[model samples]
Target: MLGAQQPASDQDRRQYQRVKVMLHGRLMLSDRTEHRCQVVDMSPGSAFFATDATAKTGERVIAYIDHIGRLEGTVARVRDDGFALELNTTPRKKAKLAAQLTWLANKHELDLPEDRRHERILPRNPSGILSLEDGRQYRCRIIDLSVSGAAVEINVRPALGTQVTLGNMRGQVVRHFEDGIAIEFAVIQRRETLQQYLS
Candidate 1:
């Protein structure tokens, strides 16, 4: 998708494929105040989010999204329920956002569960970041890793089914232990992302 000042034509806008996505996140306005939001739809250069928080059109915003990291943008349209964010990120970040949108579009197209036995292996590098959907972050250790899920050693126990990001893989709390919690990846990750992010 092309990224610049603005789409030159309707065809250019059409070329910027819009994907229906539902990612939980939070955004900070120019005042640096945060509000809970869910990204409802996204394109290469913009995103729409559902939030009770009101923002004026043309206001600058910075958002921390699940799975997809941080995005900087400005409010393009304000709706009764939410607002559209016109992204001002670099071209590379926009390209990354496009790829993430593609993945979200095909999210239900699951691959056959890899490692049917769900073997857990100790990661060579145990350091990882645990992030909640609301954007709270904590340092965590990868106690064990597998293609489908992970046992992370962190201080807090998010309620079961709470969506979270472990390393760069999106998952949810499946179980909780005394010292940490168990996470099941939202999608069975490809070997490349699994290794590249975790190992």
Candidate 2:
């Protein structure tokens, strides 16, 4: 019995590791129409999003999940509320996804920061353009960077919940300060995504 255990295959891991989550983001159909969706459950191999929009089984989908970045797959099964996604990924990508899920699941259990899994750091290039959905743009200096949000020093203060884009990242104004505003990103962003613009 002691010698029977071995490293599990990806398929085996996928079957056992489905995680329940409430990640908000958007999904695009094969025709390129985007719809707002919420990921209710996920695993490296598959995920399910709760949304009114539905697609036929086998239809290709591209979803941008909050905190998880872009995922491409085909519709596996349709439920009344939503559909399951069968992730198309390489071994490396699957491993990366598994790690992210583990972190999200364990962060709270480990008594880590509840607001964000990662710590905020000063950006390499602090200057950035803050743009509103209404076509207004303002100059801003990045105060700090975290995967979930950023604090920027700007001249204008947008009301809480005002949607804005910092450089290329979409976020919402969550708080106001005398010097600037706090922006929570629409999705949990990869450090690379932050550096692409911040650097």
Candidate 3:
């Protein structure tokens, strides 16, 4: 996370465990253009991202990182605010980029981003259809999890704080953004459900 003051131009741009970079241009992935995203932070292995677009976990995209440059990433998790990107193995290129990333992270002594600052653990984002009670199945991605809450990203925008069900877990929407919902678990205990589903 960046402190209040901007780094002086003459000063080296610090690399954080997560680094925020203003997106420079529109990027295309899967016939869709993902616009207006800020890099939350990055390492050579992976970078966290915040975007206001409809995206699914495990989806891969070509992302352009400032200084470090553009590379492909796999969606790891989704949240109301945004989703996280994980690096995939590509032998030669991955090794080279990873070395570069480690250098930046060490040189900057970067702090963790807000999303990762807490001790909370979230579910690994899944790519699949969730069948609802009424026989309607929705395409959604697991966002995050806590003992009392969880979040999901769906194409439909439900009202703020609305109660919704995902699988056997039920929770209330704590926050709503352009393309996601932050739900507070109300029915299934967070630990139990995560274990069963993830296992």
Q: In candidate 3, what are the lDDT values of residues 19-71, reduced to their tens digit?
A: 43322223445557766465656554566666676568878777665334566
TM-score, cand. 2 vs. native: 0.57
Q: By descending lDDT, how would the candidates be arranged?
A: 2, 1, 3
Off by over 4 Å in 3: 1-26, 110-199
Task: Look at candidate 1 and tell me the lDDT of residue 112.
Answer: 22
Write model 1 residue lDDT over 1-199, tens digit each, in one string. 5555442234534778888766677799898789988887888877898999889998988888766778877788899999988777665776777887776566434432122466677878888899987899999988887878888889998886578998789877766778898787866677666674455
Give the TM-score of each candidate: 0.57, 0.57, 0.39
Residue 30 lDDT in candidate 3: 57
Tens-place lDDT per residue, model 2, 1-26, is: 43342233466545658887656788
Q: What's each prediction's clash count?
A: 0, 1, 4
List runs of model 1 lying over 4 Å from the truth: 1-12, 111-199
Q: What is the lDDT of every predicted structure here?
A: 0.76, 0.79, 0.54
Question: Model 3: how far is 20 from its true place, Å?
Answer: 8.0
Backbone steric clashes in candidate 2, count: 1
